[model samples]
Target: MDIDRRTLLGATAMPFVPSVLSAAVSADDWGSIAREYDVTREIIQLEHGNWGMMPRPVLQAYRAMIERVNRDTSYYARRGMAGDLEGVRAQVADAMGVAIEEIVLTRNATEAMKALILQYNRLQSGDAVLYADLDYDSMQASMQALATTRGVRVMKMALPEPATRQNLLDAYRMAFDADPGIRMVLLTHVSHRTGLVLPVAEIATMARQRGIDAIVDAAHSVGQLDFRLPELRADFIGMNLHKWIGAPLGVGALYIRKDRIDAIDPDPAEDPARTDIDARVHTGTPDYAAQLTVPAALAFQAAIGGSRREARLKQLRDRWVRPLRDMPQVQILTPDDPAMYGAITSFRLRGRTSHDENVELARTLLERHGIFTVHRDGLASGSCVRVTPALATQESELDRLVEAIRELAS
Candidate 1:
């Protein structure tokens, strides 16, 4: 139960041996790499945006850790778990390219984001806060709560449909210019509803210039995209290891820059004067086994370089999207710009935008085509089905999706 660096590294290093981590990875190489995962034969899973399935090596490591934790019980929890957890924290911090003191593990991104949103001390009476329709539902509710809790006005905006990097930037600039009272803005790095990748750093910079604070929701971007924490240029961020990093479902991290830790109040249970980032979140009795297995997940992702994994996922997305783009009845939610999207994309029938219509659309895809997808709401345009492809997803599955859409549209 006491995990050291050597033991953690040893558990994950040997199992993954991807043939190619380069741009020109061959089809056979991708096939071999796909074999590392154990996906279900019951359906073609295209809803990986919910959470990632642990690769075989990471799954085995998790099972072993679960067994060890059960066997040791409180003996390990009381004696050596703290030290082991610090090692895991260090690993997560290193993977994120941040100092160990600046980040703390949480049960999930929602918990981390709620803590940051509720505890932020910068808001004053009559000040305004901004969020978009595409932000996660829970985060939107949390931002709405600020109106009652902090006496601030809540502002919501809609992103452009055929989004471009320049137009997106212009939208934020216009919003900030229109509302000088806006004190904080919520930015989602990649939209869960429609895989639109925001220019977070630029947007954050614009907010700062207007004396506003930006809280970033990076739940879908951290492992799905190849970038470091610093590149975001934000002092506050909440990200998930379970979504794209391939960790167990209960693991995530909260980040507060070293100088800006004071801007967020500590959890009610902790002393307000305490300066450490750990005081910001208080999750009683977290999943120790899940947390301890984070290194194995990081190792698994490292084996297949981040850039290569990103390219593979986008390739899978483009396969289905390109063929359907010309269809008059199909409406692809995400744009074709390479920098504006990742593995996730949502779409709806041209005239069908109701919740029930999208629900039926998702049902037909599953029942008729044997491909699994989920419907998402809250976009200004309307409800649509979200399709997310994992690293293990085969090109054949995507081709099947394309065929299914074509037939349905006809």
Candidate 2:
């Protein structure tokens, strides 16, 4: 009698578990060792780096919070609920290695980035603010809106893919070099389109050297990458916990280096030093329970082990690269360099028009095949599907994605 593969593999797995992990790794075994959270790959969910699906505990906590709030709305508010919210922010601040005094809880990275960008000392008529064309559209739109209303200049740089990190570093240098008058620089922690992980420390160093304020839109970096807030040294940094952190959708964090806090003007109102982290993020009263659940998400990250989580995501990524890296028409936009990519990777359909074709492709895959992905329509590149995986993604599941793309491309 031969033992089944699943049974044999399960007997040899480790007992350690992360509350918020999507998958577990054990020795050479490829299956998710942890109890299944039931996120099937039947349709192929390779875009987790875009929006991290919550683990069971997080989903349960979220649903319970909503139910409790609805049961006794008044009792929950104007009570000890506010303290719980603060605790969540403090834990997040500590995890990111930033002081709570300099942190602000927000709905997403875009909100935090916009709040900081709006606070530039002053944007003179001829003074310009620089950002990459790859920056998220929302952040880019905020700059454009300011440009139109404030008579400021907007300088955009279009970065190429399959390029070296120095190529990116040089692009920023070129953009700023062309116009020494560029007062502020907006950058992405990970290009949502190219999946390029930039040398943020180097970029921040250049900004300080040039006397420019660097505000980074880190919608994709936080949980997917090991980020220490204190070391980044950017004037302003915003992160979305929901993307790779596996938190509820409403939660995100902004870390302002304590010394740099004074440099930023806190939106329409000035928040006293004692105010909660929401000083700039408070858009009227929000769902306190929604905010309170963020720490649980962080706990999940801690349990999985940060570096190990990164390694697992990388393992899943390799499954795709092995098959598609050699494809001729498939332009792997993501840097093959491990230092430059995490859970997210992008590719352009060479000899193809991706814009409308990709938009339709997105809907068709999701509706017909149940595969969900980003259309990449927002970027200058017309359209292509981006695949990203969380720790929970299995090799067999990832193979499904490579097979589909190869078939489509072939």
Estimate TM-scores for all models: 0.95, 0.87
The alpha-carbon deviation from the true structure for residue 346 of candidate 1, after best TM-score superposition, in angstroms, is 0.6
lDDT score at residue 392, model 1, on the 0-100 scale: 82
Report lDDT (Cα) of residue 74, candidate 2: 78
Clashes of each: 0, 3
Cα deviation of 135, candidate 1, in Å: 0.2
| Candidate 1, residue 192: how far the Cα is off, in Å | 0.7
Model 1 misplaced stretches (Cα beyond 4 Å): 1-28
lDDT of each: 0.89, 0.71
- Model 2's number of clashes is 3
lDDT (Cα, tens digit) per residue for candidate 2, span 176-293: 7889888888888888876778888888888778878888888888877876776677868988988777878877777777666656555666554633335555566666556766
**Which residue pairs of candidate 2 clash?**
22-392, 23-392, 46-388
Error of 2 at 346 (Å): 1.3
Poorly placed runs, candidate 2 (over 4 Å): 1-30, 33-36, 40-42, 269-277, 360-370
Candidate 2 C-alpha error for residue 139, in Å:
0.5
